[model samples]
Target: MAYEAKTKATDSSVLEFIENVESAKKREDAYQLVDIFTEVTGYEAKMWGPSIIGFGTYHYKYASGHEGDAPLAGFSPRKAKISLYFATEDTSREELLQQLGKHEAAKACVYINKVADINVAILKTLISQSVSFLQERYPNHN
Candidate 1:
């Protein structure tokens, strides 16, 4: 059997999803991030799975042979924090995070309480770099 990706793009309305976000502040930030990510990736926002608002698509197969498709850059507004999805493997990930404002970095997600908590410029850089890095590695950008 082949592996399947749970976070595939859906036919959901991105705007509706954001509007349904419980927190007014997070909902507003989600809209702002949609603009920033769209401008940076030059791709329209798409709903990935249930929550993630993704910009671009890429397919990846690791050395262990697990493969799946995911967004080049995206984010989800959870109850606790906004989860920023970017390519952590990118060389500039660390440098960009340094310039980013108050945020906590994890293996794959960057957690921020609000968009105002971080520098938008650095966020844009991180999104662009993530797209570039994945495109190079996967070359199967959709």
Candidate 2:
């Protein structure tokens, strides 16, 4: 059987999701991120699964034959921290993260307390680079 990704894109309203964020600061930051991501990626925001607000899409198939579609760039406003999703394998991601200000790095996600704590310019670069990397790696998705 073909595998399916749990975090598929949904028709849910992005603005509604932002408005529903429990923390007012996170809600406000989410709106700002939406604007930044949309402007940088030149793609409108779409809700991915329950919480993620994503821009653009890419389909990836690994050697193991597991494949799924994922957003080129995205973020989520969680209760404790905001999670920024990007191309994990991007070469420059680590170097850029050093300049991202206060943030925690996971394998594919960067967690920030708030937008005010990070450099917006770096975030834009990250978003752009992520989109470029994914588009290059998965040309058909572009």
Candidate 3:
């Protein structure tokens, strides 16, 4: 059987999702992220799964034969923090994260309390770099 990805893009409204965020600050930050991500990636926002607002899409197949389609860049406004999703394989992400301001780094996600806590410029660079890296790595997907 083929591996199935739980987080698939849906036709759900991105704005609606943002508006539903429990925290007013996170809601506002989500709106700002929509603008920043759309502008930087040149892709409109789309809802991925339940919470993520994603831009662009890429299909990836690993050596193990597991494959799935995912957004090139995306974020989620959770209760405690905003989770920023970027390309994990990008070489420049580590250096860029250092300048990202107050944020917690996971393997592929960066968690920020709010947009005000981070450098927007660095975030833009990270988004651009992630898109570029994914496009390069998975040329056919983009």
Candidate 4:
């Protein structure tokens, strides 16, 4: 399925999400993640996949023969944790993640429970690096 971008402004539901969670800690974490992504990717925030606040975007294809488009790097502020989408798995970032302080990685994203749990600077750098890495792999990505 093709991903659809949010055409309307950031809605009240997202705001309600922030308020309903009622945790200053989580709200602060979401703010930090957004700031980190902006600083690294240099792309302004945009709503993606309903809850995701995405940065840059790129087209991609997996070896499994599945191919599609996705945010070059981004994250979602789910109630449980922050999902950081780097979209590329590169060994070069393995060492960087060690320097990133605290975080966990799934197949395509770095998961953080809170911003205080990780080094914001290193996270920003990693996101930027991942975008560059994917761009090298997919030049048409924009």
How many clashes would you count in candidate 3? 0
Instruction: Supply the TM-score for candidate 4.
Output: 0.77
What is candidate 4's lDDT per residue for 87-138, written digit by digit as tens?
5456768877888777888777778888887887778778878888889998
| lDDT comparison, 1 vs 3, better candidate | 3
Q: Which stretches of candidate 1 lie over 4 Å from their true place?
A: 88-91
lDDT per residue (tens digit) for residues 1-142 in model 2? 8878999999999999999998888988999999999999999999999999999999999999999999999999999899999884546888899999999998989999999999999999999999998999999895
Whole-model alpha-carbon lDDT for candidate 1: 0.91
TM-score of candidate 1 relative to the true fold: 0.94
| Cand. 2 Cα-lDDT | 0.93
- Per-candidate local distance difference test: 0.91, 0.93, 0.93, 0.73
Instruction: Tell me the spans in candidate 2 whose CA falls farther than 4 Å from its real position.
Output: 88-90
lDDT tens digits by residue: candidate 3, 25-142:
9999999999999999999999999988999999998999999999999999999889999994546788899999999999989999999999999999999998998999999875
Once fitted onto the true fold, the runs of candidate 4 whose alpha carbons sit more than 4 angstroms away are: 1-22, 62-65
The lDDT ranking, best first, is 3, 2, 1, 4
Worst 10 residues of 2 by lDDT: 86-95
Listing every candidate in turn, what is its Cα RMSD in Å to the true structure after a full C-alpha superposition?
1.3, 1.1, 1.0, 3.9
lDDT of 3 at 45: 98
Evaluated at residue 63, the lDDT of candidate 2 is: 98
Give the TM-score of each candidate: 0.94, 0.96, 0.97, 0.77
